[model samples]
Target: MLRMLKKMDGVILFVLLLLMVMSVFTVYSAIQSDPKLGNHHIKTLQFYGIGFVALIGIGLVNYKLYIQYAFYIYGFGIVLLILVNFIGGTINNANGWIKINDYLSFQPAELFKMILILFLAHVLVKRKNSTLHFWKDIVPIGLWTFVPFALVMIQNDLGNALGYIVILVAVLWIGNIKLSHALIALAIVGVTFFGFVKAYTSYHDEIFTFLEKANREHWAERIDPWLVPDKATSKASWHTKNAGLAIGSGGITGKGYMQGTSVQSGRVPYTYSDSIFVVIAEEFGFVGGSVLLLMYFILIHRMVLIALQCRDRAGPVVIVGIIGMLLYQVFENIGAFLGLMPLTGITLPFISYGGTSLLINMACIGLVMSIKLYGQEDEDELLMGEQRPTLLERLWSMVKKEKTTA
Candidate 1:
């Protein structure tokens, strides 16, 4: 166990600790400004305490065992997702959380993020590193991914719903998608998005009326603020507009910690949760924001390096999926505040004050650490001529064998 603990990545550990510090400090500042947040900073510390425990426990386990049981895990996550639709309560605009009790509820959509990666990695490993055939490989994978995507969308959780798409695309790319198929997909997505924008801008009133009649006007509320700002009502565009104002007010050095007028005034919504970036920016300014971003960059860079060094094919596949998810979450969250992307209410990853978000993200680190710990060949397997399979290897062979992997 001590030897396994030695395998943990020191760089990643330090960065998580740093992010934990940042999260706690930011949450404290947010609560000071927004009374409704009430001691979330204390809760943030407790969540981090639990997150580290999860990270260590998960890291000690062999990730191959996870891939081996990927199907069962995927089915379980899907079951919870389906169950939420029947018995869950709504939070904000999304109805994706299942209440375990009065104080602890979880979003299966978040849980599915990790499960999807494991299952997709397992599915792709069966292809043996060859270029994926569209119908046989890519299509089926898309259909598998579509199951959760469609389910999350039904819950009105657009942010988590879109995250599934991000994961599927990233995993497929690493799974060796064909370049021609990739190009075609790129073209189709581009044209579809462009056409969507065109149709919405051209027929704003008609689209708004249709959405209103369908009781899905919230969709228009989010889109109009981004697409046609002029047409968006004060109520519809209030969040984005206010977030923009708060961030812009935080010039070079910022208004100083706990001194953000906009944030303290509560003009920005969800400041403790989704809009935490606004607090960092308002309090610490561009410099503070850049520092946090640098930490994220370094953390991802370290993971990429670990993936590159991994001997097992599955290690890199899983790491790439994780990378894609983290990148998308950070981009969408901060970008929404800057108006570079539409508001999706996606948390700012480690820095955001969501229990489920923090726990899942920490577990992702543990997954990466597990790969780092178990995915490489040891000295006995390398220097010695022939050696017995280690315990992890024994468990792996029990599941399935893959010639393409290390």
Candidate 2:
């Protein structure tokens, strides 16, 4: 156990601890002004304890075991998603949560993020050396991605559906897809997105009418405010407007801890969850937010380093999928907070006050840690073998010999 602890990625563990500590402090501040949510920070702390255990426990297990059981994990996630559609309760007008009781409910979509990554890594590693064909290679992977994506969309959780898409794209990028084929697909998506935007801007009224007829008025409501700033004062745009204001108000140093007027006044909805970034920005200002961003930068950088060092295809592929998940969440959450993108309700990974997201993210980190600890052994042997060393290996050996001589 002690040896394993020494082998763990210290940088990642530190970042996770820092984020959890910040979560407790920020959540406390965000909830202090509200009588009803006074104890929410306590729950956040409890979740942190649970997340810590999950992180270490999952890290101790061999990640190959997970790859072996990838299908079962993916199927279980699908079952949970299907169960939510049938018997789940609604929160924030989205039927994505499954209530186990009055006090306990979880968003299965969060768990699905990790499961999808595992499944993709398994499939991609299996087909790593196979010939890439649009029909034979890509379609099966697309079908795997589409199932959970369609299920999540059915639950009206567009933000998480987008997350699934990000994971798929990331895996496919490293999954041996042909460069020209990937470029062609990206070009098609780009053109389609531009065409949709042009049509919407040119004929918004017609688009709105069609959306209303199609029972997607909620999407229209979200799009309208982005299209016309004048409409931002509407109920649908209330959260975005307030979030932007809170972030802008904290210019440099901020108003100080627990001193945010918008947060105290309850103007920004979901301050402890989706809008937690607003709370941190409003209280700690741009400096604090930048510090948090720097932490994430280090975390992602370490993960990428591990991916590069991994000797096996599955290890690196899994890390890429995780990187995709974290990157998309950070970008989408902060973009929505700044009104640069539509409000997606995606929580900031560790800093947000959600048990499910926090736990799942920690588990993903645990998987990365497992790869770091176990995956490097084989590579180290190869590096120090009796064969003629490459330039890089010779340099590495010299460094090691110097340290030993010292």
Candidate 3:
């Protein structure tokens, strides 16, 4: 246990702590004028407490164990998702959550993100770092990813659904996907997206009416602001419009903490949850948002270093998949509010206030930490090639050396 604790990455842990501070404060400010949210800042602290336990506890375990049973874990995840489809209650119009009595309901889709990462890595690692075969390797991976993607979409959770493809593309890239195959897939996706947007705008009413009849009108609400803001109803565009205005209002320095006019006045909804980025932007300005992103950059940079330094093939594959999961969530969450993308249920990775999302993300980091601790066959290999010290190893070595000198 002490050994695993010693292996923990100090830089990443420190960044998580900083984010916890930011999440708690921002959630507090976001809920100040909204009475229903009710002490979400306190709840944020409690969730972080549990999340730290998950982080360190999972980090202490060998990550390879996850890969070993990846299929079974995936089966379990599928069971949960399927179960939710039947017994799950709706939240925010998405019937993707299962209730555990009144005070404890969880989202299966959130947990499945990590499961699919492990499962996909397990599949990719079987190629032994060789070029993946088009039919045998690539097709199987796509099928596996698509199954969960379809399931999540069935529940109307577009944010989590998009994540499966992102994870698939990432693992395939690292898994030695053929350049020719990659280019073809890329072209298909580009054409599909462009055509969808053009069609969506051209036949707005026709498509929206179809969606409305199918009980998915919210889909139209999400896309209209991004694709054709001019045509979006005030009701459909209000969230992104006010969010953008509030963010722009912050200027360089911001309106001061907890002083966001739009936020306190209830112009933007979900500020305490998915729109939490608005609070940080409105209260602290571009400087604050930049600082938060800088921390995220450092966190990702450190994990990428860990992946690059790992001696095991599977170690890097798992890390890459996890990286994809996180990068998509962070980018999409912030992008939706900026009107650069359609709104979805995705939220800022660590800075958002949700028990399930925060804990699952912390566990993903734990999986990364596990790779750093156990992925190597020996301590000597912890250094990056030959004798060059990795950033993690150098920082850790200095800390230990200072203790020895003392």
Candidate 4:
């Protein structure tokens, strides 16, 4: 097992560990000022430890078993998403979570993202070269992606829905999709988005009128605050404003742990959870933020390297999909906090305090490790050779041969 892990991607594991540690420190700072939530920090650390164990355990299991169960897992995941729409608890305005009594809750969508990756890997591995012509061969792939997207959207969890789509695009691109197909898909998305904007403009009066009728003042206020921040003073904009202030106050080196006024004063909403990164930025400063960003870059970079080293297409697809999910969520969470993007309640992967997300993220790492443990290296090198050219390739092949044999 040690030999196998060594053969796998060490850089990714190192980066993940660094980020996990960072999360504990940051989460501690975020909650330390509040006596009501003082003990929450300790509880979060325990969850992280448990998640680490699960990640290692999963890594030890054969990745092939996951492939075998891809369809069933995907089916179950979709069903969970569907169930959550009716039975799920509301967080903010989005109804996307399921409460498991007082201490634990689960997001079916989080579980679904992992399953979708597995299913995509299974489909792509079987479809093989057929994926060359994107649309011609990738409609089935789109179906696999969209079913979850539609379900999550119905749950009104746009952030997670978008996360799912982003993962699909990343896996599809890495799976050897045609460049033209990618462009065409992008074109379609642009056009659809444009149409949505136009429709919103034309129906603006009607929507505003309906907002009054429904008395959804909280939900209705988002558009105005987002559109014109200075003019919007409602609760909808308060989270965004306070988050920005916390990040801005951090300056260069930060104010020191537990020294942030807004964080300590509890000015920033969701500081210990969805917007935890802001607290880290405030107290630790830009230096700390840069370190956190570096950790993410390393984790992503290592995951990509692992995918490239995968014995088969499935491993690469799985790894890339997970990479996409993390990248999207990180960008959404941090971007919104820093006022770079819209407020989209997406958790900051392992850093955010959520049991379901932490478990799923660790489970994702486990699968990547599993691929490393049981995966064949020779097959990937051969595939890599096929993508290149020449008789020196034979010489190059002999070198790889020696390396594998050695």
Error of 3 at 157 (Å): 0.4
Model 1 C-alpha lDDT per residue in residues 1-406, reported as the tens digit of each score: 9998887999999999999999998888787755666889999999999999999999999888788778999999999999999998999878999898978888899989999999999888777678999998999999999999999999999999899999999998888999999999999999999999999999999999998997778989988888899999999899999989989999988999889998888888888899999999988899999999999999999999999998866888899999999999999999988878888889998999999999999999999999898879642332222344778989888666654453
lDDT of each: 0.90, 0.86, 0.89, 0.79
For residues 246-347, what per-residue lDDT tens digits would candidate 2 score against the true structure? 999998988899999999889998899989999989988999999999999999999999999988778898999999999999999998767677777799
| Runs in model 2 lying further than 4 Å from the true structure | 213-215, 231-233, 377-406
Cα displacement (angstroms), candidate 3, residue 4, comes to 2.2
Q: Per-residue lDDT for 291-390 in model 4, tens only?
A: 8888888777777767776667678888888988988998888888766676777888888877888889989989988877766644432333233345
- What is the Cα-based TM-score of model 4? 0.86
Candidate 4 yields a Cα-based lDDT of 0.79
> Alpha carbon lDDT of residue 36, candidate 4?
78
| lDDT (10s digit) by residue, model 3, range 1-406 | 8867987899999999999999999999999887877878999999999999999999988887777778899999999999999999999989999898777679999999999999988777666678988888888888998999999999999999999989899988888888999999999999999999889989999999999999999999989999988888999999999999999999998999989999999899999889989989999999999999999999999999999889877788888888888889889989998877799979899988899999999999999999999877642321222334567998999999999999
In model 3, what lDDT does residue 109 have? 95
Against the hidden reference, what TM-scores do the models get? 0.93, 0.90, 0.92, 0.86
- Which of candidates 1 and 2 reaches a greater TM-score? 1
Worst 10 residues of 3 by lDDT: 379-388
